[model samples]
Target chain A: MAANRSIDNFWAVIPAGGAGTRLWPLSRAGAPKFLHDLTGSGMSLLQETWARLAPLAEERFVVVTGRAHRAAVTEQLPSLGPGAVLAEPSPRDSMAAIGLAAALLERDDPDAVMGSFAADHVIADHEAFSESVRVAVDAARADWLVTLGIEPTFPSSAFGYIHLGEDLPGVTGARAVRAFVEKPSTDVAEGYLATGAYRWNAGMFVVRPGVLLDLLARWHPEFAAALRAIAADVSLLEELWPTLPKIALDHAIAEPAAEAGRVAVVPASFAWDDVGDFDSLAGLLDRSGAGTTVLGDSSLVRVFESSGLVVPRSGRVVAVVGLDDVVVVDTPDALLVTTRERAQQVKEIVAGLRDADRHDLT
Target chain B: MAANRSIDNFWAVIPAGGAGTRLWPLSRAGAPKFLHDLTGSGMSLLQETWARLAPLAEERFVVVTGRAHRAAVTEQLPSLGPGAVLAEPSPRDSMAAIGLAAALLERDDPDAVMGSFAADHVIADHEAFSESVRVAVDAARADWLVTLGIEPTFPSSAFGYIHLGEDLPGVTGARAVRAFVEKPSTDVAEGYLATGAYRWNAGMFVVRPGVLLDLLARWHPEFAAALRAIAADVSLLEELWPTLPKIALDHAIAEPAAEAGRVAVVPASFAWDDVGDFDSLAGLLDRSGAGTTVLGDSSLVRVFESSGLVVPRSGRVVAVVGLDDVVVVDTPDALLVTTRERAQQVKEIVAGLRDADRHDLT
Candidate 1:
């Protein structure tokens, strides 16, 4: 495994968050999805995220995470020093989390190109991902807010789509992002797929710190100034963090910038998964195709005439029989049994648990 | 709740055996189904069986179980005397397990009429069950090997059927056993259900101890003599028990006696369930028709649009979603997720575990 050479003036920004309630017991509030390895790989998703970026960013990295996960992020990515991992006083969603990182990086590296990626995504074929990042970094250096639009393999209504504009003159795979669309219906998604221009918006943004903050300042100047003020004082974070707007970066910046013709997309066909639910996790992990898939130790599972996923997280033996696409997630404190088609409805169970005051399980 | 009066010289013979592999993890090899309180009734199935028969037999009881399960059976039924519970050296099926008890009772009480009932069966109506046993005992007194035939509730192909002959002259519910047929096909079972002459063979037998051994002697003389010799001298149990035939009481005695016109059936309209699998166990424990049924503490389970039985035995929260007739059995070390329709297939999983040499789980 030959490592790619570190890119010049490039930094990595990892936003590790989300309770992942759809995944339920496997990914809980105490320990979210990024801290654990959803894939059977030895590395946690956060660690894998760091590994994927270390080749390009080398020692230049900034991690934005909630206060609850600060110690875990520090422990998981041991090479990241105290100054590198920024602990948010309170969650203000993606805009505040990523903008704070941008504000800090702008002061540290005057000519830096930062690629913002989520910590909980699964990326197969790292070579293709690296190539996309390399091109996105090039687009970012030119001050074009670069976003990697993943080539859609199927008509998945779960994800938002990116409409591409005319191709950038010099950049090989870079094209101007026309519009960032919200998640559409399956029938509508099929029409978008047939057009051969729409791509999955993976929320991967590459840009200079000034470019993202400048774009935010165009709409919410005070919000961008607050992030910069927190970056300047560092101690003002506790008081000013919660005062910022609670919104996703796509809605706050990316979607607006795309309409302004300031956002560019570098389309990559590498396999990517957000692992939003057990069904998606099962699909991402359906490699064995031997009727049943054991995401943990194979020895801990026993299946007969069954197909789908069985996660034995409690070191207990799980037996599934005569079921198709069934998902059984066994943990120390909770267990979930459902079909793949009903996996999205698992969030309803989490909501029910919350209503019943089962805070420990949710 | 009036307790039934003790019948003269009537002894209760409880044969507590079977691995109950269909129930798996909940009913393991080390802890069989008979020792568990599967119905959320606080008392185990073995205890429930003893309670039902204790009123009729008083202190006259003989429980034959495997050596491994002797302690558990005794612990569940603490009222039994020292010699009342017999521990077999090894499993030799129902014939050897029950015949040994009959031989011992034949000598202890010369006028003893013993009724043999399995320890793991669930009967809902105690009054009806008590009345049927009394009628079966009366038929037994007339020198007939009497069986309590349960009224078939459906066209079930899982159980053997008993064809009835003309009613006895004096006995109201007692009829001559025309034949004891094996498990029939569902189509054939439907025809059996249409005819009122067929009843499910619950394998319940009541007969005088001497008469039961005498009948055993006619077909298997040497086997009968060995059992009698063991009863006469308890020291020969470990030495001679292994040499006896391993056969069910039905195939070894009831079928032959029914063919010889020496068997009689007392049709009992009581609700009896073998609780053979999770499906039958679910059906038996479905006291509330609230769509979803919880067998253990109801508070520990959370369901959303699901129907079936959830046994939360591990003191952990179990959530089920968008499933119908689903069966979830959670234990400390193992868990089973399946549908009520495919409950029988769980036996194949148990066999697979045994074949894989996972005795710790099986």
Candidate 2:
């Protein structure tokens, strides 16, 4: 209940722009994963993300998304103010999307500490997530770029790792980030896990708007200046957006800040998932460890001697029989069938469709 | 070219009434396998069967189908005369369906030699098939209930085996049928294959109409009498159809006649498939041994590192990735996803759907 109180001068910046190609047919260019209710909660992932952050960052939200998705983002979160959603003209990647929000928040509230979380990730235990964000916010007030580090549940080769250093002197449960490592091989991830000093870098960053801009300016001065200029003119976004570098926030600011010893990590024991592929999705939905895990209308799916994921979105009966760990995603126009282990290769199909000039399906 | 010529007084009796539970969604109760184009040949199985037999039977064809499917049968075979398709009041198994045809042929043509072939089977070599039917007809003229025995392509346990006896005294290319063995284990089938005295019984029976009726009478006197009574007076079909025995033709006549040394078989080297399940259906379509054998429009299917059967009948793009021997059948009302190995279990799903009163899907 303590985590329900709104943090003073804190803003939640959500970057909602990923194609999520691995979840093809269900997650399309026109309707990305954030727009879909993958968890059968009757709420899209974007709406769930907004609900989780509203209590802590009450009425202080800035959702940065692609221009094509701006209207959808606003529609999903109707309570937000007029200027709460920032529309990027094109895909400039994570750095430009988040940094632009930081520049605008800095101009509106000089003392604003912004927490940037992706709009499509799944989080369990909202109280623990809120508590971790609270600690990260406290560290952010001390002029440090703080990230909430998730406890590694497995030796996953798909996620980057945050090397944990000594605990911060004054901030409890917050540690200095020794380094931010890229996604490693499974063997290397196992080594990282054995040391007991690495946490999953879930890309949840909290920092004062000025501190983030200054860090970006330290590495790429023009990138920071362009974003600040866009925030100043309000009309310069179209002119300056194409000029900004396309890079993830992790590479643009987090890694460099960690190397410069200005990054802090708040260790949190809460379940978090990017829902990267069908395998991860099956795990998330198959909590009972029983029959097929249906993400959509359960009435639409009928399974016999099968245990995996079936998303029946096209209002048809989906029958899965005698296949284990299979993935079947049925939409109105396109359907995907694969195994959990081979789910990552779905992106190849999407790419092939695009190359074949079947963009209508892609 | 000899196979393209019509045979004198030869009638093709097509019994087109199987649920084809294994090929669900694609083959439903309202639309069985005989009404589908499983071979990607731009024609339904019934149409293909009619085309194959038109040369031999000419206009002498009798297609016995359930009353529910009579309209579809007539629609598929538009060239058939008004009285050619005989609609049974309900299903009384193959015995009643084919026996009624035999009784009608006997009344219409005293010397009619009827060749009964299922409306939903796939034959690769048309010339060889016609040649085999010719030999079977020759044997049928000698008062023998003749069956076409397909040479064993593999040790298949899914089909009944025909035990080949000594050569017929006078009928060239035809031999005595010693016995009919039910589906056996793989090891038992392998032994049957090694002996070189067994063939897969595809249930192609050739015989004079009176001879067939006499053979049926020898086993089930009431069943034969009822069929004859229905044929004598068409008005009695609705009253007597349900009273007829619900048994397969093999059980009612062929097995008993073989035991009495009254059955003969024409050895056939042509390819034949019942298409009983998705695995068999995949084999029938994947002639090139290539990626993803699509039964419907190939343009609607996209595969990456996957091979098997994909039927995209619902006009949806079906994409398969990193799975081998997978079976995906998508229809407008229902969809089926499984592996070729597990395709046999699809019937279990159909049975479950029927049990749950989801007849709309079944």
Candidate 3:
């Protein structure tokens, strides 16, 4: 495995799922977070991800999204061929979703290495991200599951931590992964930050398609077999997808493989964000001091003596006054108003809406 | 003048102006707050006011609103016959708007006693309001400019105070108004409340049409003469209205009249609110403890761990979470998010929108 080596056999598998329930009204069930131009950028997150990967995975892009978002995914990424966007029949969690892509890549390209990235994430430095992916792809060729470990800037308890072992012998900036820990408490996170040996596990994985499936076969034999069988017979997808176990890829393969001393991590010093909620969205906008950051049309948001993020997607004027860290997401059919601190609680609102049988709103 | 006596020639003068800018996005320039049903009741504030005054000033309603909102006023007050709604050429302030009504009544009925009330105010007890008005009208006939003084519930500096003097010789609940003061400081207001000799001057004025003209003539002879000319020739209103002074009735008449011992106050024990801002609006729609008070369709607003006022007029689902004293006003063309304490600062947002020349939104 060599760093900065271009591998023509590498495919970029973008898992465009997640309704982003916490960012309600802006991110709806029909139109998820991946489809929104959340950072006021001209391109949607999915489009931005495609743009970032196009140079490396040119004509090797495979986007897997829910059945409902098939047309939207294709529309957002017009450069991709019709067959490039794979529509899942049902939500089978990350393991099945990403596993299905691996199974398909395994059959389509015998020597293919794949780098899996979520469609809704925001990466600031494209050159750094691509360089890290190239390094991970080189490591993937050596029959090792590789992940891009982001250098933690702060002791953030919001994400899982990736523990670093000894440096991978012959690979630059690549280290063997000791273990992948779950989201830690603030106290534990601060200690990990102090040691300077742990990185934020952003769920970015690069691996050989065949190797990933084989690793899945060790822990989730039926799940791997179902995904491979479906990849073999595309007609059986609708009948088989729901039968697959609902599990995130981290728990299904990455965590287990790391514990067995078979995984490696590439330390990348680039800004990465999942854009999980309004608070993260506010940080992305970066308007410090007391004034609102309008993600949509600036003309549509009027603020005075206030600071926050206002997403006015409904073509209506949004006025925020005398508030701190407030979030006003005005969509056509629904509205969400909350503070950045209370952003996590928005998930409860979505759950409550679902429980109240307001499926149209949820 | 006898207390509680029903006068045959009494007219209800409703000055239905003011864009209610502080309540912006809900109250607009074309469709002001007077035309909105701020309370959950099934009638607009204007309609509710008309209903409350129907018993005494039967069919004797004169509504003064901006030319832009003339049609909406007539539409809301459908029972009013042709020429009942008086559209102002421009906003000439309270004095000119109400003075026009007085001039019209003076010529139509020499014995008419006009009770001028704003169309946007809310009163909890209709019976108590009517009783106060009857007494005010009684005092009005005795050559006194009568006002309804609401008993202070709190030391709110938002409204002006009417200093009470010795009790009127014959009229019950009626006393001589020592002076009509401007909005006082909270400390001074608290002191006035402690003394129990001050009452909230709700701007509800009652007076004989001719007597009001004579009072105006004493101060601004040219202004009174211009109003009389417009009344004598109804066709001259469009030409003469712009010549009238832009002064509130309180400064032009009430304060001076009170100093001259020609003003009387009927101390009414009833809840009264102008619905000035979202804070006052929330106070009016009081739902103590922790929960949202929906002024529109309750089902449209879904609250979780929120205690505030949510006016969802756009027929969309409004979800407020983890906020205390929050004000969410979601309308079709605009939305306002603020806290009750910072509600007054909403005016700055409105001003900013206006300065930006987004008139359609304002």
Candidate 4:
């Protein structure tokens, strides 16, 4: 559990199983969001995420994605090998996804620590991020459920917060977890920011197979039983996986672990962005006075004397004349023009497209 | 010649011969602007032009247009009998076009008063326009070359003005033309508006077979000789029509006639709009304080308090968010977004397209 100790035998499990309807048009049912080259960089979100972890544990990397996206995941990450694309059976939430990865990884190395990462977040400072993961890995090796907690850079109400208790007796830069809080209101977020003892729960985690299995068995017996049943017959896992309960890992496991005094928080100082909404991408982009991000080969022909516009697609020129704080996404088939503050309501456009049966575009 | 005289044998010679690059994308080289259903009202400019003149002179209407648009012209106006579609050898200007129409009509009736009308001008009051044309025909019959002059409704520098010297001794609403002024500066346009003695040269004219020929002989003898030779031989006319001098009737004849004291102006109180530029259309459109005109089936879904939009096409909803005084034209193939005052410079876009060799679009 020391700082420089090699977690070389660790497996990086990316539960890339979400349908990701929030990023529609660019991401259709056939091709999910993770596979899309959102940044117009050489790698996709999944590829970038995999590449970030590949150096640490390339041989032990596993991508647990939905059956629909299994081939795409495999095709996108050629470095992962054929067996690394673990196909999930159904559209269950993060709890089942994590359990499936755990069960599959236990077959090869039961004592190995599984570092879980979301496929869609953008981490800018790789070295700092890797160091934070290493810190979390050290904490995980000591039989404590470890979570990477990003130091809040702003009063963000979008992400849940992890309150730090008194420092852990032996672990340097690691805090004893006090409590896990849901997404806060603006005032509450400001209050949390002022306290300087809160960190954004980035949904990244590190836990040994035995520790996760024990936690799941004690807290969510049904999910643990399903995983056990799937492990018994690997060939029939696809058929049985759809019937598993849909629940987030944070609600079913992380929240309970923190409540029961079994959680450790690794204070991550790396530049991290969940990139959950257009507004969230502001930090990752090069901003002008009006908060405009012209990613890839894009040029802002004319932004109407206003601000907060992010057009990420390449070879596309977008001119938001007279608009302020608006997100205008000009894709091949559709264009989305919404206020940056109302970016959360962009899901409504997806819903509208779905209700109109425009699945080809959606 | 009197106002009440009926000119029964007159033929409506429509010079439907413009390669209107000003309205590009929608108006391609293959199908010029006159063929575009701009209003989406189930009729093209050519169709509406023919319909407007059909009541005044049926079956005798002739449309001298470019060779490429002959089929479209025929298809749109099916009632135009065989040989009514006079295919121009090439896009020579209106001087040659009018000469060709005059010569063609002379083949059937030497005494026929040619009432020349442009194929694109829109007359909102058909009855009044017809009466004005009747008065112009009477003046033409009296040996004075006649032009319908629309009384100025605004100080528009976009159009030429015809200054009246005095009311004709006997003919009602007809005046001796003093001079023809070119498109004026702002001050000159204001002065013309203030005087109330100037009228927009609506480009509609009535002349006998020899009137234009006599003017051409006196002013432009070479042009007169070329037209005479082309008119005498059908094959020569076909071969040399495109290579003939490219001059507008205003420059080649009207201005000359006014200078030589041979022109008469008939004041037209009718609502006449050339619809030459976007601003002209704005005047015709029902405007709110914001200067938006929502025509046809489409709605102007302006968000963020956008203003001054004109949706002239149908079957598609156009949303202009956070834009002011900008014209957004959404066609099946192209979308044009420009400022209202700069709409006149849309011709520059057409010129650019031509320069780029996008003949399919322009």
lDDT tens per residue, model 1, B133-200: 99998899999999999999889999999999989867778999999999999999999989888999
Q: What overall lDDT goes with each candidate model?
A: 0.91, 0.92, 0.89, 0.74
The candidates, ranked best first by DockQ, are: 2, 1, 3, 4
- The residue-by-residue lDDT of candidate 3 on A234-341, one tens digit each, is 998989998999999999999999999889999998899999999988987883635778888887887877888888888988888888888888888889888899
Candidate 4 on B214-331: residue-level lDDT in tens? 7877888877777777778878886676567888988988897888889999998988877666555555564344645654444323333455544534233343344456555544
Model 1 spans with C-alpha error above 4 angstroms: A1-3, A287-290, B1-3, B287-290
Model 3: colliding residue pairs: none
Weakest ten-residue segment in model 2 chain A by summed lDDT? A284-293
Question: What lDDT, from 0 to 1, does candidate 1 have?
Answer: 0.91
State the DockQ of every prediction.
0.86, 0.89, 0.76, 0.10
- Tell me how far the alpha carbon of residue A202 in candidate 4 is from the true structure, in angstroms, after superposition: 3.9
Q: In model 2, where do residues sit more than 4 Å from their true spots?
A: A288-290, B1-4
Which 10 consecutive residues of model 3 chain A have the lowest summed lDDT? A1-10
Question: Per-residue lDDT of B155-178 in model 2, one digit per residue for the tens?
Answer: 998899999999998889999999
TM-score of chain B of each: 0.97, 0.97, 0.96, 0.91
Looking at model 2, the pairs that clash are none
Per-residue lDDT of candidate 2, residues A4-98 (tens digit) = 79999989999999999998989999989999998888899999999899999899999999889988888889999769998889998999999
Per-residue alpha-carbon lDDT of model 3 for B1-362, expressed as tens digits? 55344557989999998889898888888778889888878899999999888878888999998889888888888899858899898999999999999999999999999999999999978889888888888899888899999999999888999999999988877999999888899999999999999999889999999999999999989999999999899899888887788899999988888889999999999889999998889988884635778887888887878888898889988988788889999888888889899998888887887788878877
Evaluated at residue B353, the lDDT of candidate 4 is 53
Ranking under lDDT, best-scoring first?
2, 1, 3, 4
